[model samples]
Target: MKSNRRQFIKISTLGTGGLALGLSSMNLNGINAAYAANKNEAVSDEDLTPYPTYCEVCFWKCAAWTYVDKKGEIRKIIGNKEDPHCNGRLCPRGTGGIGMYHDEDRLKNPLIRETKEDGTQYYRDASWEEALDLIADKMGKIKKEHGPECVALFSHGTGGKLMGHLLKAYGSSNISAPSFAQCRGPREVAFTATFGEDVQSPERTDIRDTKCLVLIGSHIGENMHNGQIQEMSDAIDNGATI
Candidate 1:
């Protein structure tokens, strides 16, 4: 009985060891296969022309280089080392920004909503000129009915600045940027109530120099604030406590 028990234990141990070895071998082979496949698809720098650009995926606006092939196809986006936002690393969204151009399901044209005789609504593609003309006609009718000041424009970004100018010239003082409200509205209000001034975007938090970081409800790493995440990493390296 004792000899049988010893044999059983040895066999079990050997079987487990063998299974682990087999799995490791399989994993190594899989990794080699992936490496070979990637090597075959590798593009040389000479084949790509890099253009300086900033990611529009999120508000971080991480500067990056858009590498295009000889055929003007956007191949990849690499973070610009000099950029203060990301340094030399782009977030997953920014890295995958090229996928936006390649996605077949992306909206490529303006669509106008039309109703069927039975009252079901569907959208039909329309030319850019037709869309612009329709918008202008609607705006004209609205201006005729109500004063231009009644036409409120909720907008954001650089294009929004141009639209704000157009609305201002049209005599509307009701232009508001929704981004400011969405991103920092509550924080702005709180800061104003407490400190008399709110911290602006591209906030100047000296995270790297801080010894202790207290996050009340902030999701710094998960929020994809590239600069803040990088600085937080440095702070952690320098013995900062969160």
Candidate 2:
């Protein structure tokens, strides 16, 4: 009986080890199958032509130099010193913005989800024309049922202006944005209460000429508002207090 138990334990251990080995081998085979071709393709600066453009990562639109290889692969993005927003510097978000274009999993086409008879949903890629036509038909049906004001938009930053325009044209006064409510709302209220009007976006704080600055909760450098931080640096250089 002891001999039989020992044999059983040995067999169980060997079976577990064999299963792990098989799984590892299958994973390696799957990886090899997925990357059968060379996966180390790269573009160098020497093979790229640099073109000046503006970043859309944030509302700032920092001027940037984009380097595109002959095959139209973007190799890099750098700040253009001429642009005041960047002052020749880019934040981490701006520097990493290239991923938006080069990401392998980024959506390239519109998708329409079709509900299967069994309650499963499957999405199919669609052309721009087809997607737009479907949206228009649905929107028309909605407007007929309710009203144009039923549509509301919550947008962000400068890129959102086009959508705002479209919504307003479609008779949507119900638009709202939390970006305004949270990020800039307090500043607007403060300025309006004190000065009878609020300053434009960016607040245009003359940090370079200020004698003293008091920070409440704002981590200026860490907030990544490039222009303000640059001006704050200049103010620090000119011997301004915290």
Candidate 3:
């Protein structure tokens, strides 16, 4: 290696202007090996913190692992291998959840629209107190003019539970969700009409031990319920007919 460096210097001295070529040609394994050896030794377990969490982007709530670096920044997200629902596997949306924490454009505070005399309106950031006051004033006027039931809600699953409770407290029964009309709404309405009760989310049906399975309007395989998928696979393996 010493002789090789001396020869390279002699070549560079010959006006070849191949300094970059000399460096590129030189073996870097020794430096790389030393760096690799010290890499783990440089970081103690105390520097890295792994937090067990879950995805809230959807109703699934697949278990996840959030790794934090020594600087206290979230480094990565990994699916929890022990989670039976997803088995350490996450969907595309779940994998992109780190954006929820680190996105620069995310709303950090309230915003209100400021209108120009020319009929143009632009939004500007506002304080939480001012925003809540405006909301309360508007909602109070609506409740006085109409009824609380006139206030409707179209929300994602469970995310609007607090708002739902608030609406109910205000004597409003017009709360609704997209999940109702698209997925569970029709089933809930039918089930409630027949059974006199609301069906629970992710309906508890044991497909594994059952002898036969009858899917009416449901495409169970495409439903994306990991537990149900596992149970269905088990039922099929145990010779249960669909």
Candidate 4:
């Protein structure tokens, strides 16, 4: 009876070892097949042009791939599939960046107003050095004569933020932005009053894991962020009502 029990134990151990070896061999065979297939597949240099980078066109700061041509010129931009923020999608503005870069109407150099008439202005080309000198002289004369308070500046967007910094550096207190007048100002004012914080871009909203989303006065359909738009579409596809 003891011999039979020992024999059973040995048989069980051998079966387990055989199974383990079979599974390992199967896994190795699968891996080799995949490697062989991949080795035979030809990948063109143009197809491999996309390289990882980051987008700064908006506050999203989405990770992206910049596709370059043979001449090393950027031909296209696409969101990185590895990015948690954009998740391999871009908005219309981000996609249109290529067009903007190649736009014929884009300003290549500094221009100065040569003549000003009733609601009309004519501009002429000027060197950056000459333009800066003229602007400095005029601003100095204005400050000396009418005081610094006489100059007021109105700006918009991230570019406006830079202008705000410039205005502060120039020692001007009369500076404002139209962000309040254009969009979500009342909501921002109320939220700030209640929470003691002002709303800002790239706000901390994890839309990916959210089951339900509520958009009040904000128009998700029109005034949409690329990430938000993609999230909304995914939510609908997953049978979550908007």
Candidate that would win on TM-score: 1
- Residue-level lDDT of model 1, residues 74-154, one tens digit each, is 767889999888888987667756655554444799989999999999999999999989988988888889878889999
lDDT ranking from best to worst? 1, 2, 3, 4
Sorting all predicted structures by TM-score, with the top scorer first, yields 1, 2, 4, 3
Q: Give lDDT tens digits, candidate 4, residues 159-227.
A: 777877777777788897766576657868876887788775544455546666676776553444667
TM-score against native, each model? 0.72, 0.69, 0.61, 0.64
Better of 1 and 4 by lDDT: 1
lDDT of 3 by residue, 154-223 (tens): 7776658988888898888887787668877887888788778877644556787976888887755454
Model 2 residue 101 lDDT score = 60
- Which 10 consecutive residues of model 3 have the lowest summed lDDT? 1-10
lDDT of each: 0.74, 0.71, 0.67, 0.64
RMSD in order of candidates = 13.2, 15.6, 17.5, 20.6
* Segments in model 4 whose C-alpha atoms lie over 4 Å from true places: 1-63, 116-121, 180-201, 206-212
Best by lDDT: 1
The weakest ten consecutive residues by lDDT in model 4 span 1-10
Q: TM-score for model 2?
A: 0.69
On TM-score, the stronger of 1 and 3 is: 1
